[model samples]
Target: MKRKRIPNKKWAAPVLGLALVLPAALPAQAATPAQAAVKSIEFVGMNAPAGAQQMAQVYTGASVKVTYGDGTVKTFPLAYKQLFKSTDSVGGTIAGVSVDANGKPIMDTSAPNNPVPYVSDAPDANSLFQVPGMSPTSLGGNPLSLVTHYEYITSNNAGDSAYGLVPASMSLTKIDQNKTTGELTPVELQKVDFSGVDGLWIPCNGSLTPWNTHLGSEEYEADARAYEADPTQTYLSSFVQNYYQDTTKKGNPYDYNYIVEVSVDQDNKASAVKHYSLGRFSHELAKVAPDGKTVYFGDDGGNTMLFMYVADKAQDLSAGTLYAAKWIQTSAANGGSANLEWISLGHATDDEIRAEIDKGLTFSDIFETSDKPADGFATIKTYPSGKTEYLKLKPGMEKAAAFLESRRYAAMLGATSEFNKMEGVTLNAKDKKAYIAMSYVEKSMEKDSKGADPVDDIHVDKISSGVTYELSLGGGQKDRSGEAIASDYVPQTMKGLLWGEDLSAPDAKGDTAADDKVANPDNLSYSEQLRTLFIGEDSGMHANNYVWAYNIDTGKLSRILSTPSGAEATGLQAVEDLNGFSYVMSNLQHPGDEMIVPDPLKTEVLNNIDANFNNRKSGVVGYVSGIPSMEQIAAAAPEESGGGQISSPADDSLIPLRDTAQAAGAKVDWHGKNKEVVVTKGTHTLRLNVGEKTALLDGKSVSLPVVTQFSKGKVMFPSGVWDQFAKL
Candidate 1:
């Protein structure tokens, strides 16, 4: 593979200045009749103008219809306003404002707002009486008590150009529903801050911990060597020292990739704390089990491995014992099942590791310099506090080796490190199983190898799709000591339950046939009550990535929601409010409308672009309700003489297209060749294509889940389509 080289222009400036200055200082004696004139060559570099691409219009205040497995559909209108403009206020605090030592306004209290009365010894001591353009009166009620707070993690897809030099952050918000009108309002709290941790880099999907804190993962950190070598990156040196605590080294590779815990108090004041003991790597998500002691993490990169951290105590992840997983290959295919065993990579407290680094002992020095035995074990000695301790590294390494060089240490410890982008781990506590999503199972991970870059060494006959594996918790399996482990779930015997078929390459027609495909499963969430798993996509191969629900019992996958063009469906979480309404909180990230357009659109065409695209907003978080089953909806309805209209059977309720056309005073025609039904009412016409969810209404594409249905030899359609078509 050839790499592009950046021209070295540093010497150009000095050489050009020297040439210009020397000509004027030339001595008269040196100027001879036969002296040749100095020939000057000028090199001009031209910079092209920043090109603009066609930005897809962001859909705001729009309703999306969700079709269930039982043929029941529900529509959820945009609950929150499209978050594109930087100044568009979502939510903030009014009462907690106070002046800091620097005279800057800050939220003083971290107390969560609840029904319980709040008491302060000096309530008005350090409080600010007023703030310009902000109300003095506080909205003191606990707005988030009933509603779940969705902290959306936004990534700067456009790199430094999108959000300046700082890494993108997460936003905390809650959806409020109006009881009478059933309208939803999105209340924005404060944007999460990392404080002294500097800024996060490419924040990805995270997990809501058992203690209710958000475990945010940072992806794609800068290469340690590159950051240290570049003089312009000197500003990051202090940040690296603060996190890595290695003053002897210019930049530590151990910094900036661990899972950071973010907590939002009742007043919506957010704070962050990094848990360095969890072992740093390119983390995708960190899911805590029901016990809250064991946390499973997925590394989202090539040559990565599954990692687990068993905390010293429940709900406390600050200190833990880290381990890596080794898969016992039982099959020879991409989706093949494998029995898993955990290899202890050893552990140490954060303070102990920092102390070791202070003693000028790099994590690499302890393991890399140790002598290995023929039996595949190394004995490394360590002195934490003047007392020498020996570590019997089975597949041997240092105690702090896993925390510093996690991926490399795992591979050396006989753990499977060939997984390509292992992403999104979730637990099905009810079934005592853990589910992991592998985005596109590569051929390299299908076999065991000792070579570095196993991906290149293996042969891939066919391009494999993404797959979700279900691993059983230890129910009857015995550990190395032959002791029966009870519910001590380590990932073992993984079976492929769901496959993202759309990840396959495009066919001869340049079409992927992705209608039934759910490619690139990125974020996953499991519902205990519903026995369903929610899968979100992060792929550009599809026209619009979608959020799907896969029932564990029935094996039915439903495309519940689709995001706007050029955006990924992220942050899929299910929560129940006090009103008993189950809602799926989801985010649409980096909509396509923000991309640069190659050919500029005409003024008229550009004007049609939604105003939301006029500003730079990368993502939007919203909630989807009305997701109950048809039977549940019907059961909840009140009894009446003719029964409730919404609960009636679809066959009797749906009206024929001919009858609707006559009532609307429109002409109807059926095109057998195209398998389309055309209905024209005055100047407006709708083309309903059979077996397709999309319909063309007056030259505009509209999604109608069931555009036309056949009932009793008559072509019938949902009556709801009439109401929507009439408005158009």
Candidate 2:
């Protein structure tokens, strides 16, 4: 209980409303009734960018009060991040301009579902992978074992016609060399200090602590809300230290507001610190928790609150306790389900949970306050359910008891559809599992006639897509599995994470899937040694900025990189040290809108579009291979080769794999660079640094770190990498 050390980047505004959170109040049940009655609304304002001269107007209505999930309750108006100009055409498709139950947009739908088929701009597409043993440098080089390199650096909170931003790239190659022409060009190693100012630091989704910080995340807002929503936009604010304290613009030397935490050296760059107590309202990633105590971050904006900071005094992790997973719905919970523990968030004191109206609290207490209890939380009861889900609420718990469990501690503040949108998170420290990437995106948009925004339209009925879940850390307070240290975290029973999907998608649907169909989805990176996962897709087919990979056990469709610039792979880290797992991205919206600036008010006016829009966009470590081991795919093809064996898309109900072993001889570690790989595992173990010299493994003998002792013969270790010979 050493609480009260709250001085490290204090932020006390966003609805300190009143604070009173109650869930043990019980007995009001009409099963559960108290949601649906609170309207007044009106705040619609964001538009004015196209070369701009002066536009600042954004207030976009504000009345608050939203709670749904049967408990019902509603009010209207309020969505930030606007540019709207389009008019009608509902999800039908056309020029494009819909999204207003909150994704912002009232008109402008003339043309947007056209281009969707590019597979590499093909200047050799990177050489297609030079055959023979393959080539990310003969399989043993920059393949995926990358030491460090991530790019994206421009996002202060939306709006960009290029007041700043640029410098995007992709790299990593290897995979039986299908001739991607010898890959490797990518080399930025990390750029995100953009708060240092240059490209505006739009870092996008980040957080990789273990003493080795890298927090990144800076989605946008500031420069006084991007110059009050539109005055032509300028950006630069984690507060800009109170807007740069004094010095009138230009090289103000430093101060840069907050939410940064930089560090990546060994050549990877990154450097800042900020953290501003972890509050800015647009963050997108922060995972911490390796017993490093807790960090759990998320703001995804719109109504905001899926926090958790608890480090109190333990990990020296600055301060502690700040919970907000809210959602209880218990009638003895099951399937109809609802149970995400911890509540003691903050807004400072609890004037009634910072603000008002709590008849049994369910809307995040009206805007978060979950005070007290956080330091080492321990039970309020119930949390493990279904197979382990994602999106919200924890059940299997783990990561140090979902960071010390928090039961009935107090302070719950939620408002806005059971709590406005939250997305992406994964902490499967190998089975402890925890994955979430939600987006009811304003309860699945499609709300027009003022049911009050939701029908901003992105092809309605698929509700702008983007959802992922998985939990199962296994319960805390020692119901079992707590001190196991680490093992079992499957990437689902979810707790040590938070998609906490951070900002934009009040049904924005990946911004109308870039014109009549996004289905959002960005929230990726899984590679348990390539059981796979990747994802990305913020636009349509070729899936803009392409990146598929699914199959973690059977999600199926295992490899496809593509990318050259439909750019939107925002924040995706997968490192795997020894430079093996490579993938750092953060290309904020790179080729998105292709270079930006093509609204022409609406319609596909076509000014000459082509910043490499999706059909050719790959940078930020696109491919990386060489991880085959099952005695080298049983000598390169030998029935089942080894280990588990077949399909089911992870778990659609099992089936597949009993192929009796089938065989084309299996393994093939070849890393030429892009011809993708596919070996779900067979006791897999191909570890080649191929940095040079002494690299044999099939022939026997190995050793190469420090960049790789230095390549030359003896450099063996690729007995066909893992294998999957034809006809299995």
Candidate 3:
């Protein structure tokens, strides 16, 4: 691809010859407009100034003072960014330009000129990778490949609203992080193509497997009715036939809803495989135990059930025995613990399940064939005792029950199907416990006399405040391999480790009574090293949802970070760097609602709104790094140095002339006339428009290497202009 060049003559006016002259002596008062008018001009290259390599600290109101159980409180402020900003890193924006299968730019169908819109964007389920001693053939010569796996949430608005169309896919890219400055730059490498799995739907919160692969959860699967009702939708029609292998079974529920594994090689190539044996449901996250064989999954919907998939072999989820938890109430109340037993739904290989679907076996067929008694229960014969037990479904229907309608099958087989909006699940191997988040615990556990018999006595008042349960893995009879058995062993009751009611408090400003609770805990992740659980929320109860860190040992609940208004904190992953510094990677999805922007960031937030853009609501993925101790934060005070240089704490980079002009108490107008960006500091004024290399600096022409770019609706100058702005 050839790079476009800008005209230089239009920006080549002669300088005043005294542009670089600095006033040696000045009055106590500020310089007048005439004296301060810039006369000297010197164009410099793109390198940053000295000391720029050092990492700088930035703070924002989006912070929380976390009080630990040990009585230690530390305030951690969040450093955030929206879309791609040049000041963020040397590599500028790291967006993947949408391309066809043949590697050509995909032209927009709606545009008259058929312009190629860079629609393949938005980072989700971001996980960092550091593979040392990687072969040249693997990483294309880089011995160490530092990359982050980004799952594209949705392709476009149509894909989000339309259930028929499969959305955009995931991608892997090399991220260059400056060691000295702690700056990050993402470089698009390869788009992960799901050849085997066909494609994904609503790729949501995911987990980084122990074997170093990305496990992305396919959230909500389209109902079979949607596909059957509309055969004209080619995407749905193709998906039904390709995956299900039967056009007649258009509404086969088993075709979708599986955890897809994505592996990226050193060559920047990616391959995906759908783990059908893991069973299917509205999966929010699939977390593997330290053993890797036992996988725990959370169903993110109302009246769902928790699932466990025990693989035949370690680190292999391809072939597994799917089991559902049978919650046996040991205590009388809703928050009380309940003994958990895994009821075998069935076991089958991916090929075997697909073969059943190919044989014209539908979900209704399996449900109808299952044995049901008048009391509404299924019978399963015990292995050693040979005693027939009353459950909801027959044991023989594993092929259909486990793979097809897993939630219904589990419920029939005596699994607790009363969970409401069951979200992320993570296991603490060291502690031998697993944690599950229930976004609406009270609502989910509400008693219904007309509903199922198991939930008849369960009456709980609706509380939007969510809850997290910690299940104790009890001692169980071992299998031949001495592995902790699943079928026969029943776990001790689950305990409520953290309650949303306790976490809920008024906001710091005391503006509202219901301001500060962590509602709708959608994603949960456990860090073995820290013995802490990270909670990410997607809730409407609060103005902005937050990401919290709960210490299991100390029972300390800390609200670490919160999302902007109208956005959810997603893909929360806490990974320790090679230097052993713990960092969290999270995505702020669809932020920038004027109502949600804090008072401090209102101006900048409002300025970020671009009405003409497509992804105006798109948010950015940021890493919280260099967390300081409470003592350090208290000791350090704001500097009062007054210099021509101004810096942006958000990007941790030097502010451009536009921002600096405003900081210097000068008028800065944008999109005034001819969509131009005008900045006036002291007596000097600079004017430039988008897609123009010529800039009017103090009524004189100045040539730039490239046309100015817009980031988050603000005009941004190229890196080459940094040196010129430094002289101001």
**Clash tally, candidates in order:** 11, 195, 10
Query: How many clashing residue pairs, candidate 2?
Result: 195
lDDT of 3 at 8: 12
Candidate 2 per-residue lDDT over residues 293-356, each given as its tens digit = 5566544433334555545444444444445554443221111124454434332211221122
Local distance difference test values of all predictions, in order:
0.48, 0.30, 0.51
User: Which regions of candidate 1 fall more than 4 Å away from where they truly are?
Assistant: 1-87, 91-142, 145-165, 174-184, 196-199, 221-251, 354-397, 446-464, 475-487, 502-513, 593-612, 615-617, 629-728
Candidates sorted by TM-score, best first: 3, 1, 2
Q: Please identify which of the two predictions, 1 or 2, would achieve the higher TM-score against the true structure.
A: 1
Candidate 3's C-alpha runs over 4 A off are 1-122, 135-164, 179-183, 225-253, 331-336, 358-360, 369-397, 449-461, 477-491, 502-513, 592-615, 628-728
Estimate TM-scores for all models.
0.60, 0.26, 0.63
55-78: candidate 3 lDDT, tens digit per residue:
011112234333222233444444
Q: Is candidate 2 or candidate 3 better by lDDT?
A: 3
| Candidate 3 colliding pairs | 18-40, 19-39, 19-40, 20-40, 138-266, 138-267, 139-266, 378-391, 378-392, 392-412
Top-TM-score candidate index: 3
- RMSD each, Å: 23.3, 26.7, 20.6
Q: Between candidates 1 and 2, which one is better according to lDDT?
A: 1
